[model samples]
Target: MNGDWLLLGRDGRLSVYLPSDGAALWRAERAPAGPWEAPRRIGGDQELLPGLSIGRGPDGYGHLVAWRPVGTDRSDLVHTTHFRPLLAPLDWQPAGHPNKQGARTGTPAVAVDAQGRAHVFVRNGGGGMSMVAQKEKGGWEPWRDLKGRGVQEEPAAVTGESGRVELYAAVTGGIRHWRQEQPGARPVPGEGVDAAVRPGTLRALATSEESTTVLFTDDDSGELCAWRPGEKPMPLVAAAGPGPVSAVRCVIDGHDCTLVAQRSTSGRVAFAAYPSQQEALGAVWTESGPELPADAVVSLALDADGRLVAATLSPSTGQLRLARRKDEPGLALGPWQAV
Candidate 1:
């Protein structure tokens, strides 16, 4: 599962972080439809774990957080950032403590708040939630646990419409959540909903200041479900395989909509667009492009030009394949091409 592998930087460029022997970056200038630049590997010989969690603020600063292997089984949560004048040197720093505590951290889910501070959440070694954030002045706060049991890996964290940071994770029987009452406030436990959430598939899309819609697959049935605060769980289409889905909120033909991409039954990328937060109105799934490898994971994001971009990372070649929404009516995408 991707913890937000692709992101749109402030300079109107879209960058995808690849977990190779080290952290690598591929930048496309004038994105949505881009002129892709050569891939540049960042960092020294530090070998990062597979997932890269990316977060950016309105001011355009971007941060990447991931687990870098320490000893045999432990890892250090390293965070790196990029701002203006793109040619600056990159620094990877271990947040909180190192592996000295014998903690084996998982991939982190990160989000930048209104103040441009990166908030990172990861499943701790004790099967609970542990988090670290960038202090307002500078530097990171201590790693603290947001108590919960049986928390899954790769929680979905996002800045809400009001700038408050919120998070959702797939827990034992359903999904659990945490949110800040206001911007820059510490996140406390929020109301959690009971649904059959597939671990690593719990994704939250913040539609308003007070609530976020969470989407996930049923662990037992493989069907999709959407859970909104104070609303009953709504059932969606079935996913042909067992991977996470990518969702982005954008305007289509002047109507607010949410675009979702998942693995089709035929092991290809499929897309669907529906009224945002109006799941009961129904959505129709359409498969796009030729078949991808059965294990390929797909994700979606809005490019700098406000175009909906759907992407899948090739498992065999490690190349990122991308397609953007067509300018015509309905849910259509241009030809899939490698970046």
Candidate 2:
């Protein structure tokens, strides 16, 4: 399979694009390099609501999940997997039943563990958080409610070095965390991590086997902060700024780092980096890249060559633009060129 960068987004419809060929992978039968292949329309004729989640499975396939409304108040969680071969079609399947009588909520969050099993988290019809996993043999398990009322957003999940899965979500009072120590283990909620973070702004990055980093915006100050397993939320920036609209954890120059795309109060979008997991709280965040419009929602991913790629959506124009930076060392993003 090719190690090219894969980007997914939705603007009236869902689409997938390969921005560039990082390695010399065979091209699709008739497709060539440059200007992403005509985006493959994956949403079909259905009304694809916002909130698309993508994860790479252990089998080297990419898994995607999104919510599609069925009735006035109900929506179903649609799933699909894609392979990397040039021109390989995306095979989307109805993973399971609708979200508990068609609950209207944010997009579901999916995480593929080292074992290659996918765990999906979302808000159910009753306004509680729920989850369902794909069985090892095949098929999906029934929906299991984790029981949290007034969930403000979809849950974020990541697998640890010990094979334990940790999940995080914003609740009525604060952010709630749960952990499944092992496969089939009931998810146990942790002590209150913090209550100062803004709802729906939580993003988790599992930087290494033994540690995971949580990033969110302060509810009162709007400043960016970081939290680890047993530490208090420490401010990464002194001044108030928009929390990360999109972030990703990837290795750069053999160092585990986080790339964050944040919007300032002045309505400018720029990229920042947190390079070391060990000194995350103390390390200075290096900012770079040209500012995007305030309305642009961005997503971050690392190409096979470890370069950073960003996809931005302009709501006013309804256009999805792709860009990348290759020369910067560490977290200093170079100038962006539209792909």
Candidate 3:
């Protein structure tokens, strides 16, 4: 009930906004605020908590994951930090060592599992190496080196039913999936090279109480598709324009499945849905509230009863928003309300 949306601004600040009333909650600035709070350096001696990702632990605690300069450039160290929400503004409990010894880690992503634990993933420096971390009983656990894979980018995760954790990472060759429930597991590789791979990213969204589905955009072709265990990856939508697809979020209500995507080249966001997997699907493209201050987006979220909620930013200003449908056909775009 107490979760806020995070925005990464151009000025290198992560803006946190209240989801309830579209209010500006707070901002995490890069430069030190005052003498009491100095700029924290992380991973390979790089500045930690760079303006990028903001996530929530299952307990509804706010988290900001980022990287900083190790020395002067990309070759320097990058650290990953976790900020547990607190009563005082800018107050947070640090996780573990910012750096994974000396490995250069970048583009870190965080997700809260069903059991209320936070999981963090990053691209490590070792040849075909990556790291995964999870919050344990007392503190952040040791980083798990993911080997037997090529260099990867933009890793994302989600908690499935039965406390199963699924992770998707974008690799140069293709995308891969890893199940944490099984220890010492290598990433299960995927087939086919995406032509529109640049804009494509992956995240597992809940489809039901028992299933979490992985969604991604085809970089070369601009197609949106999803995959679940024991099933072939099915195409949900085809390319609409030339831009690379960046972010994707899936929301399932009853039999209706809505896929929302943002285009990097055009800066446009749209939604499309299918009544059921049996029905043909096409873009139902509706107008978004507005361009977020940074890259904040509106996607589908479900309540406990499985009712769908649209998570978006207010167009009037960069505020957070959540909207519900009328539960009728034609999939109308009703009032734009605050989260």
Q: RMSD for each model, in Å, please?
A: 2.2, 6.5, 8.7
**lDDT for model 3:** 0.47
- Across residues 1-339, which tens digit of lDDT does each residue of candidate 3 receive? 111244233232333433222112343333321111222222222234332444554554545454443345442222233342222234233443234444345556666665556666666665444544554564566666665355456665665545555666667656666666543233343333332343335655546655566666666566666666556666777643343232323344444454554432344445566543421445545554444444444444433333444555543454554445556654555665543
Clashes of 1: 0
lDDT of every predicted structure (CA atoms): 0.75, 0.59, 0.47
**Highest-TM-score candidate:** 1
Put the candidates in TM-score order, highest first. Answer: 1, 2, 3
- Overall local distance difference test of candidate 2: 0.59
Runs in model 3 lying further than 4 Å from the true structure: 1-51, 68-90, 93-99, 102-104, 127-129, 182-196, 208-211, 239-256, 259-268, 275-283, 288-296, 303-307, 311-330, 337-339
lDDT per residue, candidate 2, 1-339, as tens digits? 111124332111122332111111111212221354433455345455666666655455566676666777666777766555343445455665435564656657777676777778877666777888888787788888888777777567766666666777777766777778666565677755656767556777677767777677778875677777677777765432554446677667777767677555554556666674644454334444455566655667665455666666544544455566657565545455454
Query: TM per model?
Result: 0.92, 0.79, 0.64
| Model 1 lDDT-worst window of ten | 96-105
Q: State the local distance difference test value for candidate 1.
A: 0.75
lDDT for position 91 in model 2: 47
Better by TM-score, candidate 3 or 1: 1
